[model samples]
Target chain A: MSESEYAIEVENLNIYYGNNHVIKSINLKIPQKTVFAIMGPSGCGKSTMLRSFNRLLDLNKNVRVNGSVHLFGRDIYTGDMDSVEVRREVGMVFQYPNPFPHLSIYNNIALGLKMNKLVKSDKELDERIEWALKKAGLWEEVKHRLNDYPSGLSGGQRQRLVIARVIAMKPKVIMMDEPTANIDPVGSKKIEDLIFELKKDYTIVLVTHNPAQAARVSDYVAFIYLGELVEAGETGKIFTAPESKLTEKYLTGKLV
Target chain B: MYQFDMRRIKEYSFLGVISLLSFFMIFPLFHIIFTVFVDGIGTLVSTGPVFITGTLDDGGIGPAILGTLILSFFASLIGIPIAFAVGVYAYEYPYSVIGKATTALLEITQEFPTILVGLFVTQILVLPMGTYSAIAGAFALAIILMPYVAVYTKEAMSQIPFSFREAAFSLGVTKVKTVFLIIAPIAKRGILTGLLISVAKVAGETAPLLFTAGGLYQTYPDSLTQPVGAIPLLIYTLVQSPSPADHAMAWGASLVLLLIFLAAFIPLRLSIKEVRM
Candidate 1:
């Protein structure tokens, strides 16, 4: 595929923590405005790959990355591209709901807007917050209590609030690192639906352990194993006719 | 069943012994507080409120009270900002050699004698300035408190889950904003409690002020350069005087100091409760 056709392009990527090799020789092309799901068992380097997209791994002291991650043709790892700007363009949601506990729900969304200077006026800020919350499908449940702390929300609501926080930034791509893993089944279902809804507007890189979830919500599926990308293809093809024996074994529940 | 009964007896006896030891350990603390309160209250009742507002020569602790407040305020003003900066730096680079060095330095400073701090300040500020000023005294107290505040700030910043910082950074906020706006606010209670405790600790210290402040000023200090009287210094000096009136004044000053501590500590503990909830 042409580079312009992809929202994110990775070429010969490697990541390390001190002497430990975490991700090895990864290359991926994630198309714009599509849901790309990365599935693997625990310790498979799926989340590491997602974090490297925005350079979130830069926060770790001993981390080392080789090669490049190109976001819309710009090499993000190059010295000229600021990590902060890269993060603004490529946002993330963690496995656990981690809203700012000290801030009210409205402030939690407004903080990014104010910090990024995304809005010119208070009315514009409020409008943007409302739009983001609505996009995350949390506006109706929390509309009356915008000033309440995030700790008051249910686990599902907190996750949605975190999603709203990310959406408020209006990034080109959104990374979910097992977004629903810590939530209840109902919350997980809502998140899946939200992910499906979000694919029309944003490119999504989802990391999940559940093969069924990856099959259900993703347009493209990539399976990773022991710090390597085993296979990646269209979701239907990968699920129905996997190219690798390990992928087939994992899908058939024989080698989970 | 017999083994179970024996286990129960052993546990209860152990609990009883722990309780007795705990009471023994705490006995002196309560006795000192009780004695101070009884003696100080008697002195206050006999001397009246004027004892609090009067000058040292007149058997009043007013100047001393005002002086302690001023000294603690200035010390906190000097110490807190430096402590926070060091704390944030240490927290942000916890694994760096500099961070480890700072941790080691803070531990040593915490254990270093406060009298040495006073002597050090006396050499730096007192001798050169030609007068034992409030500034020197406050500097002494600040050095004594800095390590405590820094340790507290670092621990408070550390207590915040790394995920919160990740969330802020992922939003594209600068590191400064993440630390000051997000992390500091979340760690507010712990930081404030540390500040209060440090203030209380410095307020009660007499040796440092004696060396730097040159205690026993007759009036409230008008400037940082003026010699100032502090409560602990007043109590220390009055208890050694030959006059019975001086002894009574010492009791009153001690009471006032105790009240000051209660005022800081009670609210601090309450705030801790609020934060936990």
Candidate 2:
């Protein structure tokens, strides 16, 4: 497949926070419908890089970007593309489960659909919500409590609710920034299982500091250190036979 | 043993001193409440429902109570929307020039003497309208009410974690929708409490209505454009009169005003334990 077939293509993406350079010259290509994990140590700019993909960095005035990020052959950094639309197409699940606390579980899923006017009637909204929840593997457990607030749910359940919320938007690309970092072991395993199931339809970009998670889940793994990309390739090859010294150190117990 | 005994004595005496001082600090408040309840309740009881519902001739501050309610309600209606917008603007762009200026202005206005606000409104609204209208009084009170609500709004909006903000934005809604639709609802409790507290504060203010609401006491207020009398302004007038009868009425009105303030303030303060006034 050609480069246009990729879900996201980044070229020489350089980012700065005021005067401090955060993401140095980096190039990446994320294939469609694949679990592309960007793994790095804490504070190594993986989160920042993930934020840049959907122009989330625009929310902060201090951050500046000087690179082209093309999402499926369209240059998202170009002057005319609406950033809000870009974000709608690219959904994000945070490290912490943040499903709008004020909203009920059903409204949490319906909020995006309502905002975007993606669903027409109440019945359609209900169907879409049920569909998204089922896809997130949380429908049966939460179907009875759809009217309840997210604060009543566990951390892992909240994360799944957030995922369902994002899924309700029907985003083409879904990004997870350490989605299971704050969850319990059981919850984390369920999320990993959900991730394995979700990659069939949407492009998944997983950010993790854990090499074990990357090895277990990701089809493609990119190793980043400080502000630069150390190496990126098939997860198996990178884990078993890393060409770069930094990649090997990161995969082994030495780097962290 | 002597030194150790001296240390214990020192700590005990220090506690006793602070406890005494604290009691003294709270004594004036208790004394005021006691005096008002003692002096006012008799008049309220003797006069029956007339003290609340009848005119000054009928031994009631009925018009002033009505006027206070009207002025406060109108002031909140006028102030809350503008205050909320300014607050959200300041919270969204704390570093921008207008946002910084808005925050500073809110602070300065909060510290401002309310009498000056009344005088300014009197010059612009009262003098021009050629009468002391309820609108003018409400406008004056709204000026006083703005900074309280605005400051509270900004603080409340800022208190929501950054992650929620990120999550809202990630949903691809416009910044306006994200702030107003999503974030504003979450901060609604804080904003509501602030508005009510401001209402209580403005309801009991004498200076702001001194000139703006031109002391109506004979009958119930029928027009927003006509001269109005609030409970505080009426109490101020009654306290200065030579009549002993007026003194009793003043105390009764003061007690009513105190009750109004406490009614709005106490429950709100208790509901949000983390927020400090």
Candidate 3:
């Protein structure tokens, strides 16, 4: 693949928590402006791989990363690359809705813009907040009460609020670690729709345990089991006619 | 069925005994408050509000009330920031050696006798300045209250989920910004309650002020370097005097002190209606 075609390229990536190797040496490439899904069982190191894209793993004291993860053709783990800047460029949404309770819905989105000094005027800030909220499909529901605290919102609204917060930063890539795991089915469908819509302008990396979700939202799918990649291909092909026996078993629900 | 009936009877008797014992333990506390209110209110009624501004000889505790307020205000000023800093550091670096040491030191300080703190303050500040100044008393009170503030702050800050910190970090927020804007506001109620309780605890402390504040000021204190009077000190000294008028003043002072404690405690309790964690 050409250099410009990939949003993220991992080379011989390995992660260790103290003496335990959690993510074995792996090589993968995620295309630009597409929904790339990493599907795996619990504790399969899929979340760790997603976190590595933004260097969030650096926060863990005992974890060590070996090899390189390049974002848009730049090695993010290099000595001169600031982790803060990398995080700003690559956003992440957690498995649970974690809108800051101390801030209101408007401020939750406004905070990132203000913190990064992205807006020059109040008008611009308001516009951007509205834009992000609309993109996350939360603007209509929250338009009347932007000043209300996040605790007042339902679980799904709070999750969408979190997504709005990330979108407000205008990051190059958005990573979701089971963003729909904590919401109801209706909320999950809304998020899936948002993910599909987001892929038009942003590269999205989704980590999920549900193979059906990956098949529904992702363009490309990768299956990881026991810290190793079993298959990587088109989402439909991986689900319908997987090339590997492990991927076939996992998709068929016989792999426990 | 007979055995079940016997167990039920035994359980009811045990509960009855426990309730009686609980009431017995709490009876003295209520009795003390009742006696204080009766005696103090009687004295205040007879003496009039002039008793507040009147000197000890004239049966007024105005100077002592002023002194107590000053001491607590200054002590909070000195103690709160240090305690907050220590608490934040301890919570953020919980497993670090410095964090462990700070926790251990604060635990030890909480157990240290207040009188010893007074003696230590006297030796350090009183001897050096060649006078028992109000600043010395404030310093001693601050020391005595520091552990409470630190422990409460640590509890509050730690109660904030670790994921919140990660969320802020992922947004490119600096650690200092995360602490001030996100963590601190969430923990505000906890910190404020701790501060008020610390102030109340130090306000009633008499032994520490005896050696450090010198416990006698004919007029309102004008400077931090001058000796100051506090309600606890006034009550301690006046109650021991032989004059019946002095005894009445002591009762009035005790009433004021109790009121101050209530003033601090009621607001603290109301501020935290719903516990976050």
Candidate 4:
């Protein structure tokens, strides 16, 4: 893809929790409408950088940022920028299936749309809810009991509903933070398939501790270690012929 | 076989000890409620005024009951939001120094005596107003209950897996919206149970009200500034009075208090029930 196709541009991005600098200076460009994966060892800054894209780290009051993260070239961390808008444009899913317990699956999906005022009428809202649920591959399972609480669903179903909630927002970018880490192998494969299907329109940034998952779904791969970016290239090139020893070590399971 | 017989005796003795301990723990509670019901049921049914009229004594408890309810309602109304806000701040914004300090203070508040809470409110609120009243009592009770609400709300909010917050945040929901719309709803039952427990705590309190609420039986107070009566105070006075009718009234009030406690406890218990489905 050309430079014009880039959906996110990072320039000298650095993150800190308290006085300790976590994510070292980093720069990268994520192509539009493709799956980009961030892989790193535990406690590495891979998750931190992913969080910075949408400012999830800001939830921790002690966290401080020292670099620029531009969502489609607009500075995401600027005072004039709305964090909510940044999040809506760049949605997120976590490792665990965390469907809102009090909300029904239908309401869970509808909530995002309602909060953003995306749909005006009840019929339109219902349609949007169904559309999102279908996109997440959860419509059939939850259709009969749209009013049932999300707690009634199985773990995989709950995770899908969470995804549906994100999809309902119609974001430009969907960031999945270890989306399959908490599920069984079968459930993880289902999520992998969903991610492949979702990348047609939305730019996806997936963070995974699992290198295999990154190889499976991502078009481009970025490897991070000890709060520093080790390599960024085409996924095939990064996995099979990594120029960086760190990246090679990671792919081979020699380094955690 | 002889050695095994000795071990069996030890095991039986241990079992006996546990059973006796459980009875020791339960006996007083069972005695208190049973005695109240058996002794007070007769007086409760006989006194037309006890059931129909508000008060049981010369002052009557009607105004006191109303005062207690009104005061408690206001206290809960005021404390619930404040405690909830504090809870959210403490757990949700875990990294903030202010949030940390507030949480620590709330933790300390949990150990504070109700009397001290009353004294503090009296110094700050009741004394400034120049008279004891229901509002003062409510303020005291609210202070007493704020820690409970905060502690439970913090626990409830904290119990939510980090994944939930991450998911909501990634979806572009504002922190405030995420909490109110997502976290608060999920933690509703736990929060409800906590608030109910706080209500039970405030309902049973006598020391705080003794000074702030003035322990007066107002036939009817026009406003919160007027003195009010509560079940605890009625029980206190009834227990102390030489008259048998007064003693009977106290037992009836105790039974009523027990019923209210059970009223709140039953739903709490059901919420915890293992649904077969």
The most accurate candidate by TM-score is: 1
Off by over 4 Å in 4: A1-3, B2-22, B45-64, B77-79, B91-97, B116-132, B215-225, B267-277
Better of 1 and 4 by DockQ: 1
Better of 2 and 4 by lDDT: 2
Model 3, total clashes: 1
TM-score, cand. 3 vs. native: 0.95
DockQ of all models, two decimals each: 0.65, 0.51, 0.58, 0.47
TM-score ranking of the models = 1, 3, 2, 4
* Model 1 misplaced regions, further than 4 Å: A1-3, B1-4, B268-277
lDDT of 3 by residue, B94-152 (tens): 87899999999999998899999999999999999999889999999999888999998
**How many steric clashes does model 1 contain?**
0
RMSD per model, one decimal: 2.0, 2.9, 2.3, 3.6
Residue pairs in candidate 1 whose N, alpha carbon or C atoms collide under 3 angstroms: none
- Write down the lDDT that model 4 would get: 0.82
List, residue by residue over B1-277, the lDDT tens digit for candidate 2: 4456888899999999999999999999999999988998888888899888999988898998899999999999999899988998899999999999999999999999999999999999999999999999999999999899999998978888888888888897788898987777788777777777778889889898989998899988889999999999999999999999999989999888887778768887777643211
Tens digit of per-residue lDDT, candidate 2, span A202-242: 99999999989999999999999999999999999999899
Evaluated on the second chain alone, the candidates' TM-scores are 0.94, 0.91, 0.92, 0.88
lDDT of 4 by residue, B76-124 (tens): 9888899878887887766578978888899899888888878887888
